[model samples]
Target: INGARLIMVATPANAHGDIAEQLAPFLKDDQIIMLNPGRTLGTHYFYNLLEKNGLKANVIVAEADTLIYTCRLVKNGLCRVFSLKKELHVAAHNPDDTQMVCELLSEFYDVIVPAESVLETGLSNLGVIFHPVPVILNIARIEEQSTFSHYKQGISPTVATFLEKIDNERIAIANALGVKVDTAVKWLNRIYRTEGDTLYEALQNNVAYTEVLAPTTIHTRYIYEDIQTGLVPLSILSKELGIENSAMDCVIRLASMLYNYDFYLNGRNEGIIDFQKIINSRKVAISR
Candidate 1:
């Protein structure tokens, strides 16, 4: 109903802010807009849109500390939750609304923590941005194989270091943007319900992240799932936020170069015959 007090938007990371922008005009002054999984720019985008559109509605961009902790079933336009959170942490444009929003969410969720700000909840995200790079770069060898199991694969020590690097960069970026980030690594372990202090330690210590991987070397879904969708969103977010970063740019550039090689090889085998053109075009742009 247009009279709804709370509006929740769940879309891809890149699309959430825009969706909120379009919905701003329809929202009542007291209505709360929540973006599930605000990844990075979710709050900034929504705030910018409200200012740009001259909307006076109270907007809150809330992020799930863990990815929607429920087994949900959708049928006949109804969502059934087998398990739901007891509490949720919410960050809003106005810190004063935290309690009110928490009270509203308490109807569906068991608990709601009033985070000092939305940035706190946003930075505490355990999934998308932080877990992508290690899954991709570390599994490059397996991605060339015929088949592989993604979820079951174990993380190598070297790859663990990479993940830490990415996590550090993310935290630094968040701080630079005036967003106080909680311990991202520690939060990841907490969400996973593991004993390790960080994802790296969890991978090494926890029996789950170290499950027996598939024997076959075929491509795993991790690359596309985490790298393409997850990491790409983070890179884009960092750029938009004007966060100082060279490590992420390097990783992205390396991935692009590797993808170019794949494209060239596939084209050669398929008689696509335009490899030189691709190189020339990119070179011209670089020269520009």
Candidate 2:
């Protein structure tokens, strides 16, 4: 880690802060740290952790809106890659470092592209809309250890409809924050080139999701990771901006009840993020 020029943090979102804390002492001014899929506000949260750790290193922190590959471990030492996204949106904690970060990352991945800022990359996180809802709605099968394709069979027409509602709320929150983001339906079309009038149709058309299986247990990253780092932050922003996010709120509450854990208390919230600071930062970035 100390000798690496580029460090990719690929752990679940819930562990990002811990990873930052661990890396703080070893990080150098010239190094670049990237959160593979920052989910939402990941760079901000991670930077805050670095600051709290009293690190003086000027390491460039960057985040991607989503992972570049759809893959799973096939065995102990083998992995199966379903597909690779044609393009990926990436941004740095400091807006000015975005291009350099993208350039550095491009040497390894051609799909890297600069985003407006972390706000754009964070709000553009599609997992917030895609992961938790299906798992929550299909808790029965998951607990029973019933194997099924996550996107294909898990997201039925009705579940997909509910997901669309959640996606709309996510878009509305992003708009309220003065960031432009693609709708989930449009994102599917853009990322997978699948044509559909609705998000469900587009998801159904995505062959990349064909063999993706649902989590076998109730304790999965879809809830702990997505809710903690993705929806929790979005919900917090929605409330701060006075936007109605009952759909998100409901999911958060349901997850809390199912897990017997207070997600808002444990997840990313006012305690971890300075809402006003982030909002002002976005405004400053936009004005430039």
Candidate 3:
């Protein structure tokens, strides 16, 4: 990597708010801030918070369709670039300087699709639809058994149909909320560089989903915190806009239940999930 003037972040959506808050102080007015995957309101929230806190930096937020690549640290300061994305869309909040930011980025990136606004680019988040179902549905199965791979379960015709239906509901909710979202299948292919039409079709070529599902770790990061912080608030916003579709409703309710369960567990000083504060912060969104 070159001596870049700015660095964008790509972490789980739940971490966006906290990271943005912490990073504001280190940045200067001439520097830029970018969220590689702008989980709803992430950039704007950081920008506003920085302005309110008296930080004068120029923040630039972009939303690529997918991470554009998967990265894992192999050693200290060395991350393996497991993949490379072909093209991506990006935008800046300041409409006047959007083109300038995109032009600057194009020097490092091969293809940069300049978007109308950061909001338009941010709304195209792939994680929004793909992340929730497997964890929640698997949790239901884990309640029935100690260990289970929902991926194997998802391959069944019945469960696959359920996923498809639920995905449609996610898209509907996004549309109703005026968030730009595409089919999960499309994003998967774009990110994975696959020829398949759907995620299931792509799965046929790889056994990871079937054989090696996500570990059944009892961490609060993915299941409880993610939904409470990211999905539930978005879902509530969607519902308020009259998008009370069944699947979205179910997902939201499940997150709410899990969040409450997390509180009860933490109250007893039990092994708790992290990001509990995120769940508590939902009071603000829920009350709106």
Candidate 4:
């Protein structure tokens, strides 16, 4: 166990803390743990857990903007690789170590770009933009077991308009926190190698989204986890940063009604992060 140098965690956002807890006993000082596609500031959760456990592991924790490979397991132990992401974003809790981590990661991935910090990597997560809204908007089609493609046909103009608002709030939160990030449209274009004048067009024309199937029920993670992890934090950050996040709030409320669960009380934003401190510490970490 002592020989471990880096560990990449690619679990559901909700399971990250649990996994970190399990690994706390084995993790040694200076080990690297990276959260693949940290939906909403997930690195903070992992870092905080290690500290709370009193592990004294000087771990280099980091997170990615999204998973490197878009893939599915067609069968047990069988995976189908979709498109490898063209651009990958990552940052460490310590900004000075970000380049080292990215260089190490680049050995495994063709592209590993440094974000401002983990804040930028976490905020850059497109899961908040991509997963929830279209599922909610196409509930009828989903419930009816329609074969509509999740991205190509599911995201109509109406869905795109709603996504735009969510992206706006996301951008606003980043701006308020003094980080630069992308709108969903611009991000999608870059991620999918698509040329589009609009978000809907970008999605529809993107080959990566072709044949993507819609979720079949409201019980899916697209709603549950996205609301709990994605929209919840966006709404929380919007409130903190004094931005209007009506669309995000409305989505949370609607999801609560649909599933009859109190997402706010059960969401991930309960002192899960002191983002400003994380940023400020990065400055100190880099200056040393």
Which candidate leads the pack in lDDT?
A: 2
Q: Which 10 successive residues of model 4 have the least lDDT summed?
A: 275-284
What's the residue-level lDDT of 90 in candidate 2?
95
- Indicate the TM-score of model 1: 0.64
Q: Summarize candidate 3's per-residue lDDT along 53-92 as a digit string, tens digits.
A: 5565555554544465666667998888965666677766
TM-score of each: 0.64, 0.94, 0.69, 0.90
Task: Enumerate residue pairs that collide in model 2.
Answer: none
Better of 3 and 4 by lDDT: 4
Model 1 misplacement above 4 A: 50-66, 70-87, 128-130, 138-154, 173-184, 196-198, 207-244, 255-288
Clash list (residue pairs), candidate 4: none
Worst 10 residues of 3 by lDDT: 266-275
Which ranges of candidate 2 are over 4 A from the true structure?
A: 284-288
Sort by lDDT, top down from the best: 2, 4, 3, 1
Question: Looking at candidate 1, what is the lDDT of residue 20?
Answer: 54
Better of 3 and 4 by TM-score: 4
Q: Where in model 4 is the C-alpha error above 4 Å?
A: 275-288
Q: What tens-digit string does per-residue lDDT give for candidate 4 at 192-213?
A: 6688878888887788678778
**Model 1: per-residue Cα lDDT at residue 43:** 62
Q: Candidate 3 at residue 185, lDDT?
A: 68
Tell me how many clashing residue pairs each candidate has: 7, 0, 0, 0
Model 1 lDDT on a 0 to 1 scale: 0.54
